[model samples]
Target: MIKVESLTKTYGGFTAVDNVSFVAQPGRVTGFLGPNGAGKSTSMRIMVGLTKADRGTVTVGGHDYLDIPNPGRHVGVLLDASAQHAGRTGREVLALSASTMGLPSSRVDEMLDLVSLTESESKRRVKNYSLGMRQRLGIANALMGDPQVLILDEPANGLDPAGIRWMRGLLKGYAERGGTVLLSSHLLHEVQMIADELVMIGRGQIVAQGTPADLLRESGTFFRAVESTQLVEALAAAGIEASPVADGYRTDAEAIEVGKVAAAHQITLIELKLADGGLEDLFLELTAETQRESYQTGGAA
Candidate 1:
């Protein structure tokens, strides 16, 4: 539902985003992941037309954001939680957004309840809201138009554990209902659980992009541990090499197959652990290399 093509953004001599391209499809949460200073925010800004791109294009539902009729109604963006006026109440802020879009004022109350901010507090001003409350209010404003495409950056930043879980479920549900969600976050674990696919960026470029399972499978091998004092010998007998792991030997064999092999020899099966690389491991491995290169270059200079 959303496509970014060769999106480039430069600030004078420095390039913040460089030829970055990706697609966010409906019925799945597509994660936009990168470390700090990797141009995630810059790319997001360009996509929503908040910041003009130096080159390339972005489209939501086949129309550029600026060219779309009622752009706010076509795309809901929550890039900054503190963008609202501090003097306005939560309800008033959302009411203003609705009015700007020519939407009904009832959308304001609906969104407030949707974000679970229906309860009025003594400190009702935007300035007085907690960070988490402000984040929710931002989300409420984004939902005011009930747009098909949702673009959020670090939506769970100030949320507590329960709030984070709630946000995850909400996004997942939205995707399941055929809405397109493009979310950017540094929280790998949460993304792993929430996103169906990921676009991983490093140094303003895409390092990898694929389904979480696909990326994990392609990045490394899964090993199953078979505990035996004769592990090395058994592996050698089976024409397989094994590596020592925390609990037992790790062999590049299917877990069940390895178990069968262990059982055949009566090797006294103890523990069978599967060692598969995760998103965190892959992200660190990929980005660490970039960081190392940058460090080396800086040192030379």
Candidate 2:
């Protein structure tokens, strides 16, 4: 288990993390979500003893990371995938880590196979590797020690669709085998599909933390009908206002409620289902003030 309590960090007058606290439990994949510069990376850096926190405590399992006998053996971290030595082969990189961790050279081969990095690909220099391949090598290196906890920052950044799917399965399987995972990313939709629990942060503070269902449980229902004008009129008559969304109308009312209204008016209901856009809507709503948008390709925020 990974626990963070009242963590705070600042650089000069700028606060990067503020009184933040959350747990990434064993047997679960926890998503650390936020917009860019919302303190996710800073917090993770502090967690792994990379950056000093102004205050509060973070521990993997039970002891401080620095105090652990061999921190990498207990907490696998992949904060920057491109941080590898450009001159070394992928296999050479993993071999170095395995050697430092006192593991046999066979362990390096194990990791390469685990990450599906073919023998020929593993022999190529890191500088020649694509971002996706580098990411794979990074993951293999992180798992080189067979750590109990994993802290990753945007591991899916450069992955293709299939690679993303493979990574999702790998992390989920790791958690299922009783490892703790705390992954940070701003990719909202991707995180929703993989995380068992979510911790959302903005402006250096946590905004929400809970299971997807707990935070997004109230996602409104969607309604559609063949009798366009008549359906809107019927719902309005019943005092259940629905506004246009997608190819249909969405409302706070339950599907049953909307269905009953349509049935009562003899309107041909076409579609009635749960609105699947709740996570995105909630993410936007919570981070509206913290988000920065660039209007044009070269424009500044």
Candidate 3:
């Protein structure tokens, strides 16, 4: 398991990560989620020892990342796919990583096959490869040692729909076989499809963390009515403030409660259902406030 305890980081006076703590457990896929500048990358970098934490600790298995000998055999990490050498071929890059991790050359070809990279494509220089190809090569490099733990930051950024589906199944299978996976991405729908748990961060602090179902259960109910103005006024009068949507309203009250309110107000209901896209809604709600504050102050977040 990957354990992070009160992780913190700062650049000059700006605190990038603030007392962040969480765990990516074995045999589970944990989705690390947040908006841009929410400190997900900083935390991941600290986890792999690429950046030093001003305070707190992060450990893989039972030891610190820097303390592990030949760490590649225990953990696979892909923070930036474009960070590879431009002069080297895709196969060459994997070959070099395999050599550094003390793996035989055969593992290089095995990973290439696993990622479905053709021999011709693998022979091309990194600079000539497309972004999707680069992502595949980076994934292959990470898996070259067949590490038990995976930490990927936006691995599907450049992937096509088919590639994204392939990656989802691959990681799901990997976790099923008892490997731990921590994935961070902006694609909410894709993450919702595969992630077993979610950790939401905003302004460098965790705002929510739970199973998908748990988080959704905590979200507001979506309601629509023929009398939109009356429904809004009724809900507001009952101490339930609902935000208007394109064709509906969202409130934190339960469906039964909404029904009771509508009945009391004599409002004609068109639709009432538990909201899907709960992750997206929750993320926007949490980060939008901070973003607004940043905009008002004329300072970047």
Per-model TM-score on C-alpha atoms: 0.82, 0.86, 0.94
Cα lDDT of model 3 by residue, 1-301, tens digit:
9999999999999999999999889999999999889999999999999999999999998889999999999999999999999999999999999999999999999999998999999999999988888999988988888899999999998999999999999999999999999999999988888999899998899988989888887877888899978988888888988875435777888899889989998989999977655577666766776554432211223
lDDT of each: 0.81, 0.88, 0.88
lDDT of 2 by residue, 1-301 (tens): 9999999999999999999999999999999988889999999999989999999999899988999997778889999999999999999999999989999999998999988899999999999999999999999988889999999999998899899999999999999999999998767888899999999999999999999877776557777789967988888888988877656777788889988888888889888887766577667666767889621211233
Q: List the residue pairs that clash in candidate 2.
A: none
Better of 1 and 3 by TM-score: 3
Q: List residue ranges in candidate 1 displaced over 4 A.
A: 222-277, 290-301
Quote the lDDT for 252 in model 2. 80
Candidate 2 global Cα RMSD: 4.2
Write the residue-wise lDDT of candidate 1 on 216-273 in tens digits: 7665333433445575577568876665543345566656766666777776666664
The ten-residue window of minimal lDDT in model 3 covers 292-301
Order of the predicted models by TM-score, top scorer first: 3, 2, 1
